[model samples]
Target: MHTPASMVTGIVFAPLGLVLVFTAAITPQWREGQARLGASGPGSPLRSGAKGQGKGGARPASAGALLLLRSDGLWESCLQVENSELKQCWPVAGSYRRDPRVRLAQGFILTSLFLCGTGIMLACIGVRCWTDTPLRGVAATGGLLVVIAGLLSLTALSVYTHNLPRLGMADPSKAIKSARFPRLSLHPAGSLYFGWLGSCLQMLGGSALLFSFKRPAYPDCPSCLKLRVCPACRPCPEIPNRPDNDVYEVSC
Candidate 1:
């Protein structure tokens, strides 16, 4: 007895969650930060004499430009130098492989995505409208998978968020060894928000699906159990009897 509301919700949200999770996983905007390059304005060394200066010189500006940096679930990082328009991407050195937290987060996120996909498939097959006889057990199992997927996603997100400070901190040894790389400060980007939203949707859809389980209405007669056939509309069978003469009578 799946209600129309629950069926619609599960159908809509499960797919929506899948799309959002996939989008979040692929996009590299999970964490973003910018580095300032040089000083700006009339008093700055980059800016020369008042020849180019004007009356509105009071508007101070940075002599150096900002460079954008972003990282994704895969630990692939991108750097946009001069401005955020130009992009160059690369792996995050050996940190992704060597860091335990990174490995755990990666595994959890990947697992969550897999579970979400599996749950969606199962739910599709078990949905009432798709089948003549809806399998309540199958739909419940799918809902369980979706719930687990949501939990895994939340765990992965939590782990990454908790370790963000450490991730952004520059290695003291490397900083002391070379002045080329400076410490970076990273902030949550659009993808992180998308992941959160996706996780919530998964949970909601799963719960709705689980609650949709109920016994289907029974037909009036066992003979009319066939799909789209009603007991009242079915014609009765004919009976044959003979005493002195053979005779047959049809009963409807």
Candidate 2:
């Protein structure tokens, strides 16, 4: 099998993309939120009366300064206090798991990652240079799988982006109003950007592998000549003797 340069390059890219996507999937930075606290409330430890009060009993300036929330994924959430350098994380709530958009995004992203892994394995098998013949069909199928994976990831990212605002905001429709945090705004994080980039790479690598499916052209034979023969029974032509060379030429 003839392995084209494009296929080799695609093989490299497919695995790299898979790694990035996998990393993004595991790392909790898909979405980020920052809220400025105005004086800590019931659940917060940064209350004014707690620790280190001045002689005049004035509130510390950094008491309600910065609160950071980061999500590694739909499953986990993290909180960080900027001023005190305190950090905490916990599993996502059942309400978040019940949300349709969040569930869809998680499903799609996970499926895409699975497909990418399968496609990369298939591509590796198909593009083996040691084989007598290249597995064009297998490689093409792998490329198709990779393309589908990219599409799935893109869909998940799009859905997440579209619902980001609503996801961040406190929902009045839910019964658990007190459970939701107030005055917090969310934004896309580095991991979300990495996921987007990984999807693009998967698509590009798949396309390149697809392009490698072209069949090699056969070279024309100089020895064979095209001849117009009668529709009736055709007879072989007599050989012509060559004086200079011992070779004889025959026509059909």
Candidate 3:
């Protein structure tokens, strides 16, 4: 049995892509930023209401304050103070989880994972190297599914990235006042880079697999060199003799 080159490429790329995507989904570094904690630093008695603080305390200066590193992911968020053991993490909740873009991203990523898994299974079954010929249609179908899954993941990443800062900003009233909220600038993090790369690999693998839809070319016959014939149309080694008494008529 001969395996198509595309099948091999797909087999190699699809699994790597799946691994990366899964890793990104489980990690909590989609977006990250550092917050200069002033009076809101840990153990501060004035942590609750910075709004009531006098002008002196309301300053957003970072002197003698801890820098809190915050990170957000599809499932959870984490915060840790630089050069300190203080760390906190929790599942996404409140307005963050309820945000339309966040919910869509979650759904899209889940669906993409499921579909990609199913497609990989189908591809494995279809790429039956033990058989004389591969199941081209089945392999192509799996490829299509994988391509769609990649597209879904790409969409989810795009939505999340484009609205990273606005994800949990549905309620403006809940936002910390500028005076108290330290200088926090968010940016795409490691997990997002992983996801983008994974999605690209998925698309490339699926596209390669899609080539399986075309029939494999047949090798030229040894008896008649340079002449090619499809397997189904090739002449058999032996032809049964027709009865001499029977007359046959042929029409073009």
Each candidate: how many clashes? Answer: 5, 4, 0
TM agreement with the true structure for every prediction: 0.70, 0.75, 0.79
| Per-residue lDDT of candidate 1, residues 93-176 (tens digit) | 664446677677778888988988898788777776643446666776787788898889888778877876576334546543
Per lDDT, the best of the predicted structures is 3
TM-score rank order: 3, 2, 1
Candidate 1 residue pairs in backbone clash: 38-64, 39-63, 39-64, 40-62, 40-63
lDDT (10s digit) by residue, model 3, range 1-252: 557789999878887888898899999999999976666456553354343433334432344454679899999999876654457899988898899999999999999899888888888888887765678788878888889989999999999999998888898887777644564689999999999999988898888889989876666544444455345343322222445432222110
- The residue-level lDDT of candidate 3 at 252 comes to 9
Estimate the lDDT of model 2.
0.69
- Model 2, runs deviating above 4 Å: 40-45, 48-66, 70-72, 168-170, 173-181, 221-252
| Predicted candidate 2 versus true structure: per-residue lDDT over 1-252, tens digit per residue | 446777887798877887877777777788887766544556654554334443345534465443445554666777865545457878766666567887898899899999988888888878777854567778877887898898998898889888876763345565444422454567788888888889989998887778757754443223323333222223223332345433223221
Q: Output the worst ten-in-a-row residue range by lDDT, candidate 1.
A: 231-240
Off by over 4 Å in 3: 39-63, 178-183, 222-252
Instruction: Supply the TM-score for candidate 3.
Output: 0.79
Q: Give the TM-score of candidate 2.
A: 0.75
**Model 3: how far residue 123 lies from native, Å:** 0.6
